[model samples]
Target: MKLTSALLLIFIAVHALIADGTVEGKLSVDLMKPSPSRPGYLPSPTKHPVLKPESAPAIVYLERDDGQYPRLKTNETAQIRQSGYQFHPSMVAIQTGAKVNFPNLDDEFHNVFSCSKAKHFDLGRFRKEEISSDVLFNKPGVVKIYCEIHQHMRCFVVVLDTPWFVKTDPEGKFSMKNIPAGDYWLRIFQPSERRIQERVTVMEGQTNTLNFTR
Candidate 1:
């Protein structure tokens, strides 16, 4: 009986190990420019430089076909600070129905607005040390953030349905660990609505290296 129990324990351990997996890849990104128009909010810049992946890394994630996942109900907030006439973290990706906290760290005022299909909101004139009410994203889509005070101030809020997401490094490398061995679709969104998706499989105790270019 002792020997049988030990064998059973070993089998369970190996099965658990085999059920764990990972996904890693180097993302070949093509980032786009932030929105350049905020009529009546600020002047249109004469020039706008397209962003590189190093400056604005891409957000890579695994998606569920059902378009639903267990999301947290807590009041935790993601911040987008206004400082030095720019929005820190020019790109953000979060689960659907998350609240984005916009805080103005600069001495001046900023009018934050977005016309994106995901969510449309305008936080009028956030002054120094001031913050707006939670900007809730109930849908899954890319939200373009801009400042009416500074036409050049631009950023993004990518709302997703799943929590399995990460931003690529400056060198365009990314990894996702502890994924239950299964089939999945790897995806990324950058610049604006542009995105890339691929089918992949995760295996136990193994690293899956998947690469993409676009």
Candidate 2:
């Protein structure tokens, strides 16, 4: 009986470790129309003239109501490269406290800085050969980045407090797996549109689907 009880305890522990859920969804938005201009906001220039609906990507994340979540650290470093006088891949979503490397591939000097309330820093002037160190995003919110030398150069960094975050693909599809079963506030962030949030429940060993349209 003792041996049987020990085996049962081990099985319960293993099951608890694997008791997680998946969240998947698709985002629909009209990006062809220009986003409404806001006061004191300088629109960033894009290389393309006409934009498709999927051209504007969005970030989807889950946040707990109590503002408590597991702290997950990763050795991986996200990158936003400076090339062709612009910041390639203008949008990035990362967990809070992640590091982002801004590597300059252009021969000319670039100055990356942001006055956003979430994070504020200036990566002084540097060229391709003199790359600046990685920047750490410790706060949760949007950080709009710009180059002092080039007015058209702009990018965004979305720092999320929860580790369960994913960026929608060009087709506006996104999926997040291994999320512990619980109630969470599923939120979406889009540059051209207002933010959206809804309450969602994830069941153990099951998948939850939620779609957003704008």
Candidate 3:
């Protein structure tokens, strides 16, 4: 009876261990170069809050792009808002097959679409308070979303293959849970910007924090 009870307890523990995992990380900007595409090199808080007269734009606004579980059902929802003639939360990460909702908060009508490789669709000029559309990301990659009428308006939809993922906050902090203990290939996508990649491991009942630069 003692041996049987011990075996049952071990089985339960193993099941719990296999049921969840987690990954936490920090992403920081290592400004290397000023935005060459834009001129004047303006020094404004809205654009560039902290100006380094001698600081090259090699790194700035460093953030973490963490995806927790690699192999899992990816049925999720994400929000992309239209405001200030731009898409708020410019960079978004969602799992493949996940649906994304575009909410128009502007007074005037606006059209949103993505011609990028990962996903493509046109949510034609929608009116404020009447904004609604859904797009299922069938591919996993960096998708550039833009406004048809406003050439300067742009954003990014990062279609990921895994369901477990989270974008770091402005402070570059991210936390993910329910990941079965294992290894994963982590990646980050900054909208209309660049993608960063790294590898991580999630052990049973353990949380790990990572950092990314550039």
TM-score of each: 0.80, 0.80, 0.68
Regions of candidate 1 where Cα sits further than 4 Å from its true position:
1-18, 34-54, 72-74
Candidate models: Cα lDDT each: 0.79, 0.80, 0.64
User: Runs in model 2 with CA error above 4 Å?
Assistant: 1-18, 29-56
RMSD (Cα, Å) of model 3? 8.2
- Model 2: lDDT to the true structure: 0.80
What TM-score does model 1 achieve against the real structure? 0.80
* Better candidate number, 1 or 2, judged by lDDT: 2
Model 3, span 144-165: residue lDDT tens: 7777655556666766667666
Candidate 1, residues 97-160, lDDT tens digits: the string is 7899989876677899999999999999878887578898989988988887677788888888
lDDT of 1: 0.79
Model 3 misplacement above 4 A = 1-14, 17-19, 29-75
